[model samples]
Target: MTNMLVYFLGFLLLVFGRCRTSLGQYSSDQCSWKGSGLTHEGHTRDVEQVYLRCSQGSLEWLYPTGAIIVNLRPNTFSPAASRLSVCVKPAPESSGTNVYLDLNGWLRPLLREHEQAAGLVRCFGILEGALFIEAIPRADISRRVTAFQYELVSDELTGDRPSPAEACHLCNEDQLLLAVCTKDFVARGTVTSVREDTKENRTSINVDIHRLYRQKTQVFVPGGPRARRWSGSITMPRECALKVSDDDILFTGTLRFGEARMGCATRYGDFLRWYRRAQRLGTNPCHLDTD
Candidate 1:
């Protein structure tokens, strides 16, 4: 009788333990399943494709993985619409491994209004991996098709080139104006020298200032060292690195790391003209709806 009682108690404990384990597994699986659905037009569907319901948000894998191939298709109301802009970055908690996704080359076709439908589809080959995607709608025009579709392919991609940080720094006119307004210094300068120190893994550029539209008083002097020439460093991966030649006029913002940084504004031919107009008006032209 004693032996029977002990056996019965052991059997009950084993059953209880299995039940608890099963419940935990079920909960985890449910969460993963829930994240797989696509939310669209006030309805959610459990679809294989990942869907972005809003303009700005992050997209993550339903199940954690090391690498993935993403097929993205963005739908706009019209071919001329320019509302969707997407950027991908590694999640804050992700490993130090580089996350590579080509945005400029991939997004160009989609952004062009007259491109063929086939050319607009973007396929990300393979990445060390990314945890989230950030999407923003640049145009004020109402977006009829707000949700975009994406599918994940579970293939490990090796030997693919990693994209430089500069490639992901694409910003529209409004964003550029916002940076200019908020930055401590905005200047038009000519590149005097570009030095890439391979040993130190640093890239520095020396600029000869032509004019200063803005500057902090403490750092500004009527005839100080910065009045003539200023030096700043840029951080970019060795691959797809930036090259600047002497006599290149750059519209730069000095908010990044307290150093002047050049971006898309430098590439525009009429940026300086527009910037001067904004200065005279004492307003951000990008902020005005007329722009």
Candidate 2:
């Protein structure tokens, strides 16, 4: 009876060991699906599966296990390089590690092949495994620059992933108001001419200033030098290939780095309304400079 009892105990131990081994394997499989600490082609691979989703006016790449999504807006600009920009944020429950998306290998080709269908396939780069899509005009593509420019905007997961409704809100009234309040320079100008400087590899937009509501240091007087016609090239990323046409009224902002940025004011009247609201908010948005 003692020998039988000892055998039973041994059997229970074996069963427990098997159970632990099975659980270990299961845990490994789960982690492998999340791409934990895996490397591929010299890039720290964190995505288990990558796939694209398309809707009427949006294209998105979803990584189920990675808990990340990249959504590209439809290209509305007539020029190839003028594309709708995409904003990426981390999804809830994502690992705090930086994620990497390789654009050159699979994404670039895919965009090029379906350029027409995709609309704006200018350029893309990974920022902490999040993707920022910039429009690269056709002219810039001829330069044969193999490397794409990417800006790492943030490190921490701010909040929940932006829903489709939220993603579609680009340069809305609230955004314009925020830009006017926060940005150093804000103005309305007409694009007199657009030229590309091959030597500098930059696009210059010659604008006839219409109105100035904000500047960093100098104040704008009607018909003053600050409000006069200005022609200059912005020191923006080459991937931000902005295309302006003659007589296009652009709402412009200047970054602290002295880079001029413009976005399409689709609702021009609404933008003006918001701009007025921003002006009343405080004196922060009133300094004007033509740097």
Candidate 3:
């Protein structure tokens, strides 16, 4: 998608579901999410929200990071799948580790020290009678960036497999993160997933994914002069909610999760238009899902 298209679509997302919005309302009424180990703590682990939709017989939620595995395979459960298994490993060093065996797809693993990336997920299935394995680059917010500016890249991001002989390199996880630290929390990325199986009688992963997601609010701060003022990007949790002033005044407004990060035409005005737009909306419908 064009950058403009992506931003515009994101704008629409920020504006959806609000019928009564005001310019200066501030409340914790619009943001929430759920997952084990997910946190509001700055620079710690992030929350990954997913969704799935299907008939009453369908089952959703797959993939390793998000699943419960038994003996290195996704678990066989009440859902009556041909089989299911989930697994997690230190980013692997070879094609020998078939991540697809866990989720039933061909995935190449790129092992960055701080962030292991699978540059793409190769999907295959037999439909009617034809079979295909199509490779798609990983484009999600979290996994897409395997390298960073200003950081030493130990190894270039290569598709399919990690080079055991090459050192891994990644962006400084905290550089962008530290830019937008609030007194008590940090904003993180969103996750959307889809899974599919060919059998019509069975619950497909993709169909199941649709019902599992609800939109979530996340926070971020882009770098500029504002970044220099802060000692660091991370907002370490403190008693009684760490106190920090929101100089931009945008944080005081009732903005949804992803809306606060966009920049306007000029460096200064982008945040203003974005914040004003956010303030104009109220009470995102998905806040409660955080719990």
Candidate 4:
């Protein structure tokens, strides 16, 4: 399957060239773009250009009539740029457009209007190309909008797993070490409860955090008893079989679509043992206070 995708991408290069688009009236902040299709009211085939330079942002188009090409270029350069990916989650009400990965002039369908309304997420490597969102032609364009939130994700954190079962697998020691430093949130906590959402095929775990080591986002809030401790929830695939436990566990995960995702988790005692061992060997990737 991957080979097929690679072959297709290669085929796209045969016809790859710049797309001709007319400028449309819109407002952008380099991180996000909001525009109206009414700008192309009479020009049904108009294609607008949109560029975003942040690691994450959003786009909203009202009264769709034409198309827009979104160019995503994060504000930094690194050797790991090739390992970056863009993940977009459409708003539940998003409609009237088909999203595509545009490699110059070639287009690969990524999502349809119906799929967008389902609020599904689609991800592609940064090298795949730009997003081309084309509105579906219709006589009535009222009450239609194409909207979604996008984020730049690291392949290491996502594991790039092809299957749900693999996505739930525990990371090895090396990955665990990197996860501690790269994951959005790392905390020591006890699982208070676990809830399963059959509709979403996910499990949400409620935690009472004893220590907040680091967090990229405000996933955990200070609460419980004079606001001394933090409390939050971490989401994981139901297939992982996570259960509420009294054991103190080290939680590390990334944030996706405003939710924390489980990554590498181990009992506090186990982490302390391995961390102490690594410390003695002078191979600890990063320092952490186990006490």
Please report, in order, the local distance difference test score of every candidate based on alpha carbons.
Answer: 0.37, 0.37, 0.22, 0.83
Better of 1 and 3 by lDDT: 1
lDDT tens string, model 2, 1-291? 999999999999876544221111121212111212112222222222322221112222222112222322232323332232322322222222222344532332223222323222232322213332222323222222111111211111122223434333467566665565565566666555566756444455655556665665443234523535444433333334445654444364543223454433333456655555665786334433323
Q: Model 3 residue 93 lDDT?
A: 22
Residue-by-residue lDDT tens digits, candidate 4, 1-291: 999999999877543422336654444568788888897756677788887888898999999877999988787867787688999999999999999999978999999998898777888888888999999989989999999999999865432234776777777777787778778889998888899988677789999998999998788999933367999898877888567878999999888877998889988887887788888999888998776
Q: After superposition, how far is residue 229 of candidate 3 from its true place, in Å?
A: 5.5
Winner of 1 and 2 under TM-score: 1
Root-mean-square deviation of each candidate, in angstroms? Answer: 17.1, 15.8, 26.0, 9.3
Worst 10 residues of 2 by lDDT: 21-30
Q: lDDT at 1 for candidate 2?
A: 100
Full candidate order by lDDT, most accurate first:
4, 1, 2, 3
Segments of candidate 2 deviating more than 4 angstroms: 1-169, 197-202, 217-231, 235-250, 263-267, 273-291
Please provide, for model 3 over 105-173, each residue's C-alpha lDDT reduced to its tens digit, 9 standing for 90 to 100: 333332223332332222121111111111122223233111111100111111223342321222132
Number of the top-ranking candidate, with lDDT as the measure: 4
Order the candidates by TM-score, highest first — what do you get?
4, 1, 2, 3
All candidates' TM-scores?
Answer: 0.32, 0.31, 0.18, 0.88
Report the number of the highest-TM-score candidate. 4
Q: Which wins on TM-score, candidate 2 or candidate 4? A: 4
Candidate 3 Cα deviation (angstroms), residue 227: 8.5
